[model samples]
Target: MSISPDSTNQRRRLPGSDAPAQAPSGRGLPRHLLGKLATTPTHPAITVGETLLLPLLAVVLGLAFAPQDPLLTQAAFPWPWLVPVVLALRYGPLAGLGGASVLLACWLGLNVGHWDVFPQLYFLGGLILVMLVGEFSSLWQARARRAETLQLYLDQRLEHLVRQHYLLRLSHDQLEQELIARPMSMRDALKELNQAGQDAHGAGPTPQQLLRVLSQFCQLECAAIHPVRDARPQAQPAAILGACDGLKADDPLVQQALRTGQLCHINQAVSAQQDTLYLVAAPLVDLAGDMYGLLVVRDMPFFALQQESLQTMQLLLCYYTDSLSMQRLAQPIVSQVADCPPRFAFELQRLAHMHRETQVPSVVVALEFRPQALKQDLPEQIMRLRRELDEVWPIEGPERQVLAVLMPLGTSGTAEGYVRRLEAWMQHRSQQSLAEAGIFTHVLPLDGAAPLRTVERLRAIAHA
Candidate 1:
């Protein structure tokens, strides 16, 4: 059966990555193949001279030793029979009987002058024995050859089944991801928000409208809104309402919400950060997976963390994200690149979360380079290091020099081996250690965060 490589995610090795060849499965050679497979272990050949050499020698010896009298021919000597038996084992029944006939003729010719019943009987008995041996050898070889053929056929079938299995699994994963991309409930929620936005007829901005809903209907005070598309890190302040009026993207509360993709609440009652800013924080992301910003709240004596409040915030934030995505879609393409990071990071974060649930010993490693520009040769270098199951993404800026490598199904040992190779390569290229070259790695779970969060946290650490 024919199989397409794509149908089973055919794995190809990149340059510089070496893998050993697979070992042969079958053990001993089948009997049919053994006779002709090779002349000897070290001297492999199938010359015609070699095949006839022993049989020809046997024939010469038999002729020279033949008796000239009937009395001598009566003795059943086995020397003359050896040639026919050897031929029978190697060339099968036809050659065996033919050789026996030749020996019989030689004996008859040499002893014709003193011919008797004893010589005739002796020739007949030897011919019959040689013929039987030839027939048995021929049948045994045919059966062995057929067995070898059947083994090969079964091995091919097993390979095809394995490919089909991988194809099915890949299809299953794709379907699951599509379902996760946009759930029906999230779609319905966005539809209602779109209807509301149309009815209002641009009476006010969507972000301001969302903020108003949280303050009045949701009973949340000290709230703020930040549009992710217009994110300026710590350079710009988010729109504010109460005590959390000056909260920016750099605030620990907002970072926590963005990192975890959850509504983070600061337990100020414990007084850990005596310089407390916000008490509640949530991120806004649409069903289409576009991230808008954070909704942070602080200093509300009556406000407290509850499941009902968290759910309310989630719905409100999703509506705001939908409104913002529509706004950006109306803008020109050139202005779109600046807005793509958060949305991309958002989607990647969701995928990372899904991957984390599997707990399949995955690892994410970051490679840092100085001057915020990768060398032209770096892509080739990185590709060589990558496996078929890996994902590589550039992070940390418009001029992202920090590369993150996600190794799916990687064990701790695998990670360590990869790191050693990387270090060796780096030392060879730049003659500098990783730290001296402004290169570093942030292995996943080392920072106790998801891959995307770990990247963001790593970026934050680098800047600090």
Candidate 2:
């Protein structure tokens, strides 16, 4: 069922006063602060031991290998400063500062007794020189780290883009293949629609015709079309085909379809329900935006709900409804003359005569109707039942009109079977009665009955 926008309004409203509350119901900490408390920060990559170990190792090697004389300070060639430079580059200014601290401790401990004024000054100058180098190295290494990080980021981004492009291309190709396959179903629907268009007065195809197309082309097992309502199971159905027994129109799926004004799957609409019966219900809306009826389908073949086939079903139903609109807008029926019965019978005879050599089964089904008891949709339903190979004509009398259906290749049994089917269908489809129809109805088998006898049988029913 197609859900209209107003479906939201179907829900019951809660009773309440129209006044604002004095305070908000929710009382708690702000969201950002709560999120901060909920998450833990990641540990720094460089540990304290790693930062101190490199600097301390460099100082121990320099002191143990250097000359004992104060004048031999230049002999170490500032190799200890390499430790500070490396720390500055690898871990920024903090590690550089730590390296500087290690260097001062080694200088003070090794040179404590030998430090004269000039020697101490030399030591101060050396310490200052390495600290300055450490600071400069820290700045340069930070920029290098940033550049390396940026290079990795760009490489990763480019790789992702290439992968995405390939995926999109593949998807496009698949979509093209799907599109190509889609047209086959549409073509079939269009072919049937064109034939329906050629029906009398450019009236569109009938509902049964549309259902037959949908069933055959879409491979559906059961389907129905009825006026759009919160339809209950026990209510009369407008037109039904195939095997859809025990299905309810008031199901949540049906209501959802009605409310949304779009097709809804039975499985999707009621997830809590264990059993899945039908697939979808499509709204048959007229041109004026009112829902003329609903088309409910079930038990389609596996994977039959392809995009193309569903769309074709919708289009064909629209074409069928259009025929009905045209037929409705056409001129009203005029009263028939007294000779109309014989002429109607003659047409049936003419068609039946043509099939005599082939001995194809043929018969006439006459439905007699009293003027006052006729249902408004009775004429349209009768028209809908007419096959392409069949003809329908009105036979008028003093009190009523009889609709005579001519089946050119039908047998007496075929006509008789149709009568039983029609009677049963009418019992569930409407409140119209056989008594209200005011006549007995029977098949006029062109091949089986004698001309005089057939005339007598028709007259007996016509005047009953």
Candidate 3:
């Protein structure tokens, strides 16, 4: 979905024509004109010109066919009125009236001194017809505009979903390779990032930690992270690795990434001679569309600059941005809960935000274990059964231990399924039912409440 600048500049010429096969808009002029005509013009001059041009042109053609009946009042139907009807439909009632005014002017000019012979009924009927048609046109045009706006939003949404799907698949492949070569998994790296972002002593992650994390996962050998201020990458590098050069704002890849708010690289479809100093340029933008910084890669392996590597770099940058946002969202909840894990708090706030904006439900379930169940390791068994999308925070109290599970996008049925799964697993391991094992369950749906409230409610259940 990302269009390279070079592709936009390059135009294919036709075999027999001097002009380019496609217009600069990439779509031809007819489509462009249609799009233009769909929207009402703000300039009165342009609308007036359009309204006058068509009716006058029709008058000229009518004069050639019959000079005496140029107004077409003598015809079976007032054929000349079609021009005004079309103008009204295209531009609303005002434009149609303008066109009718042109016709009226023409009629008055022809019958300058013979005003007594004016066809009152003919002009009256034409005016009434044009107005009615114009009103109908205005109504349909409004509907069409609304439909087009909705379609545009859906198209953008679909494009975003497709891009995310591609990134997810590419990241999976890159992650598998990383898992084989590196000891740290993506989750652990994100956890480290979350901790660094949540560090109260500092503002988000330090530049050095960011460079190290990128180098470890993205294989960034010579790169620099530049803080973006005033909507531009700062001149000085925030962090640099190896012999990375200073920030180049004019670099094509950097410019493209900044313009599109996406990761861009020299390997994209572009002219071979395209000028660029960096191999990759990625913006650190979160899900909320806040830009924290820009990452520029100078010296990376050619194979590593492929789609998978670029995706990994983009994914890490996004995760870093999300960590910063998550820290802010979860801070209130963490402050209230004594033993809440940073990871748990982050996911809780994230899912709560998601539910608020998207109406995608999630569940917070607290499982309390009696002292008798401590011998059975029921809490540990439940931890093992946690889904990838779920986060668990274990609360150890004086009398009992509790496992608070965060299930994202979980419905009532999903909560029941999760509890059922846990019960079955506990039975298989301990040869006893949930009640027999002295395990208690409390379910709370993440709804229209503050995240801190949700966590506080869960804490109350754990203590109860």
Name the best candidate (by TM-score): 3
Model 3 residue runs over 4 Å out of place are 1-25, 29-204, 215-222, 229-231, 242-246, 267-272, 299-312, 351-361, 411-414, 424-431
Native-to-model Cα distance after best TM-score fit, residue 454 in candidate 1, in Å: 44
Error of 3 at 456 (Å): 2.2
Model 1: weakest 10-residue lDDT segment is 14-23
Q: What is candidate 1's TM-score against the reference?
A: 0.28
Residue 447 in model 2: lDDT: 48
- State the C-alpha lDDT per candidate: 0.53, 0.56, 0.74
- TM, every model: 0.28, 0.31, 0.56
Per-prediction backbone clash count? 1, 17, 0
Off by over 4 Å in 2: 1-185, 229-234, 270-276, 330-464
Weakest 10 consecutive residues of candidate 3 by summed lDDT: 13-22
For model 2 the local lDDT of residue 164 reads 38
Q: What's model 1's lDDT at 21?
A: 18
For model 3, give the RMSD to the true fold. 10.6
| Among all candidates shown, the one with the greatest lDDT | 3
